[model samples]
Target: MEIIPKLDDRLKDSLYIQLYRYFKHEIEQFTFETGMRLPSIRYLADRLNVSNTTVQMAYQQLLAEGYIESRARSGYFIAELDSDFIESTVTPCTKLSSEDSSEQKEKHILYDFFMSDIDTDHFPLASWRKYANKLLNSEHKDVLKYGEYQGELGLRKALSDYLHRSRGVHCTPEQVVIASGTQSILHILYQLIRWKNKRLAMEDPGYQGVRRSLQGQDIKLVPIPVEKDGLSIREFKKVQADAVYITPSHQYPLGMVMPIAKRIQLLAWANEQESWIIEDDYDGEFRYRGKPIPSLQGIDEHSRVIYIGTFSKSLMPAIRVSYMVLPPALLETYKHLEWGQTASRLHQQTLTLFIENGEWEQHIRKMRTLYKKKQAVLLETIKSVMGEHVHVSGQNAGLHIVLHVKSNCPADTLIACAEKAGIKVYGTSSYLNQNKTSCSLPILLGFGGLSLNDIKQGIKLLHKAWLPYYKSSEQCSVTP
Candidate 1:
């Protein structure tokens, strides 16, 4: 076979190195199939107008790397490689057909029920922008500089006061550590706790982000089943875990609120075992039925609970601000690490001013009333449209609820069908651990981002999409 190597002189790479790369790229791209003999080094040197020595060096390097084999008198041949491994290493570039591309573009999402969305329309943008500008223009210029390694003291103080009054959490500004997001906070916590214990227990069908963070830290995870009340204390007791991460006020996806009795039991378990509890209050601000449930950290007397709160859901995801209330013991260790600030100082300063001015509280109040009505609209629409084909739960708090479908079809099929109809819904199977127990097909539907009219229309579309699989029955009653 006649072949030539392209070598660039200006690249600073040696001619032999360039030649080696060319051959390797060809082999990887399957231009030179396995067992295909390469051109004789002397002949290739003459063809490319290069010295035979350069070709020999390049061929020797390829041979050493196992990309080529030199047989006695037969010259060089391409080596047989694992096709799957080769494909994985080298991504082939190809263009999609215009028909297929246009089809993808045409799939416009008219309605999206994303699980972690909040009403962007009601965000206090004007007030926030004013405060942010004021902070940026301050004489100190501190907002432009790194505030604190732990976090800006002003933000922590405001958060401490707010959490104490609203969620019943007990903490001072010193105990607070600002983080970029929940995962960042979890990563820090994993670093601190892994020394004490590597086995961490998490709720089955829990938040996947937490699971991923723990797994990324190389910590062993024990899945504890979640019951109607909350985390099954019975199952939790059976395992020996260093710490348990839970969403007590409103369990993720499932929406089961951990009752006072269960919360007390959980604290007792932590106290007896000396195991730590991490309480994530992601959306504790939007309770519709009664007074908000007191935080697990507030009720803990033994200081076993580490409370985490975020403004992402209540305010906006782009804010990228979350805080962790560490126990005194952990705080001491965390201070020693001295991990410099992870969140933006400007955002923290602006948030501090907003919270201190009570503007944050006012915003929460407004969002709560608005979200409560949206939740009611969603539940009412599900009842009127979906009827007895499905059951719903996890309302009364948070921006999303769980819709339990009675059909035998997997959750993904329903989600795909909804997608075809320009509606978006999420499934819970991905959140489940390897040992998930519940057989019910559950999908999460969020109402926070959608208008009341959109919620009704989307539910009607979903009803039409799923009507075929649903068993005929009287309307299923659902309440928030």
Candidate 2:
């Protein structure tokens, strides 16, 4: 029997991914029994009206993930899977009630433009696996033991060197603290800084995850408005904040790179007030417009900046590696505290090797190029498809751009319409701390996880979905 996948070109996922999912589903459901031979790449390509390379990629993915195996001079065959694994992995089908069915239909999103997503298809799996396997050897058994409370020394050293070379950050290996994620690092930072008044000023309409994290600690969060350049310094001075959190490299959700003049002024304020600046430089590696902006911590003459960087965007998020550079003041405080290691010692060791061998920088350059192209495609597609129906902002940097939809409907209504059309777009309303009505119907479209074709198709579908509500500025007033 021949296996055929029903591939839809209009869907967000590429043809190879769709084909892989189809086969994986079939195999999990036992439709493709153990030892059953799959159709040849050429045969399947011709039958499915896709390229042979696409079929080969799908088969390779299945083989790598252990869904199938290939014999020399023979076609692919289904791999024998453990019964318990299958039972746990596959959800049992159940007849849904009317309400459940409606809910499921509403949640069915074909294309997702999540701001935090990254391109997993382009991850350096082979390079990562090589280093991981090397660290798993008997000679490297020390990696399996409990690591330092601060983090792996080797990784910290590697990161210190990298930050200095790329972002102009000034820090020693002793100041570097590795954690599982940015939130984990933030929690630790809070502990170190909790001795002071717990008032922290953050960007208004900023990253909600960080806002929620700080709020959970009962820290007073003052929302400073973000202007066309970045955080408004004039408003920030009004609040008696103990510390300020800002994404200066590329502001989260808004994608504004804070100007150098503002950066100097903020640092001056921190120095004069004896306050701290928590700079979360997430996705600082993918600037598309002009020369790459040096980090906020780079310009700190007073050492008031606590710099945080993560590999979740540059590499895949599953790696779960984020590091922060503590100021000498905070570093001393952190040393006195009792905290266990959060990141995996083994994974940290592997990453250290990956970086030391120069693969980390190499990977960044490759991804920077790839993301630039994806961003360009997304912008061109929006202009061609959406035209004057939307006004795009935050386009020159980061993985996402903001689209202020010229429609009378609210952001939620536009999101619902897009959802109904099987497209997923995010809103900026949740980013605001209090002023929900301040923002217009602005939608965020992330291009990092999407293919070039997916971006085009998604924008076209979005235009068609919101066509009914499209109105001119003269006809209806909409604030961006």
Candidate 3:
């Protein structure tokens, strides 16, 4: 059996990627049917006129990613298609997204609601105007030249002070490196940990974007379940991962805080396993009730934690400014890796002045009040609409709340019906980790950027869409 290879001039992907795709495309098209064996690396290499290394890399990547698993000395064969599990449990999100799907299509539409952001209107635009103008007129003369690899010095220094004081993050300016956002931080993180041959323990029913960012990478992810108290410490220990990515302040989707006990236990587990703890602290800035819980990094006696903080959630998601508060040993190694200024000199300077001039503090205080009011309205709205037909999870804090449906309604069906009715809702399946319950039913609805009126109307629309499946007394009883 021989296969001839052809090259496309327009295929900008790596040669190995092209080879990988060539085989995958054929397999997906069923040109290579079930029980078919894939060509050998050396044979494919000779036919394609590419190096053996390229063919080997392509096959190795596929094997590692579970696209094709190799049997001992039996050569490679098409993986058994677990159609039921694969179709229901896996993401509809392909690396290269399909335009035909409702999610992708709705994203392109004007009223789509996959938005993960806070109200920018609450920002002190006047202060930013002053700083922005100052940068344009004066700061640019010096900063206009190419800047530091981590970020502009002024911004880093300001952020260093702000994070330490405001968020209980433990880091010096030297330990901090600014990047575009969380994904940028994850990329650097992926590079650091990939060489260690360690599995990454990710929070189940967590952030889809983070999951997607690390998908198909060399690192294997052990998706640990998050319980009421926080991540199940027992499950965490079982994973024995190189690093654990957590949103302890308010666990994403669930809104559950990692209690102090669990926090201490998590750090101890990290120490025992010789692993790292990545504290995302994603949306810690705006807690509606109770005293501020200290960051997991602040209490760390051992330097096992890598603290990540972002300005996106508090101010605006477009801020695109996040920093990694590194451990001392890794700090020096990261210093030399800094290349082109990922953060603009002007953008940095403007952010710096905002933090320095007491603008950010005031802005956050106002936003906290505004978002608290919004949260109250959302609770009331959902209660009025869904009533006994639903239960709200993770509502103590954060900009979003997960509303769990109590009826026999499939989460996917509810989402589809909502979309058809011009309402947007994200199902629990979107955030499930491996080993997660496939039957979990919840919709994560964000409220920080929306007004009370919008919340009321949105809930009304959602209730209308939900009425079909949840109409019977068996599904829901009218609240007195």
Best by lDDT: 2
Q: How does residue 449 of candidate 3 score in lDDT?
A: 66
Q: What lDDT does candidate 3 reach at residue 298?
A: 89
Candidate 1 Cα RMSD after full superposition onto the native fold (Å): 16.5
Q: Which segments of model 2 are wrong by more than 4 Å?
A: 1-107, 195-197, 435-439, 476-479
The residue-by-residue lDDT of candidate 1 on 248-366, one tens digit each, is 88898699898999999989988998989999999998888765679999999999999998989888889899999999989878977778788999988889899999999999999
Candidate 3 residue-wise lDDT at 113: 38
Q: Name the better of 1 and 2 by TM-score.
A: 2
Clashing pairs in 1: 388-476
Which lDDT values do the candidates have, in the order given? 0.83, 0.84, 0.73
> Which is the better candidate, 1 or 3, if ranked by TM-score?
1
Q: Could you give the C-alpha RMSD of every candidate to the true structure, in order shown?
A: 16.5, 14.4, 17.7
Worst 10 residues of 1 by lDDT: 471-480
What is candidate 3's lDDT per residue for 182-271, written digit by digit as tens?
A: 888888877665435568887887777677778777777788887886788888787667788899999987888888888898888877
Clashes of each: 1, 0, 0
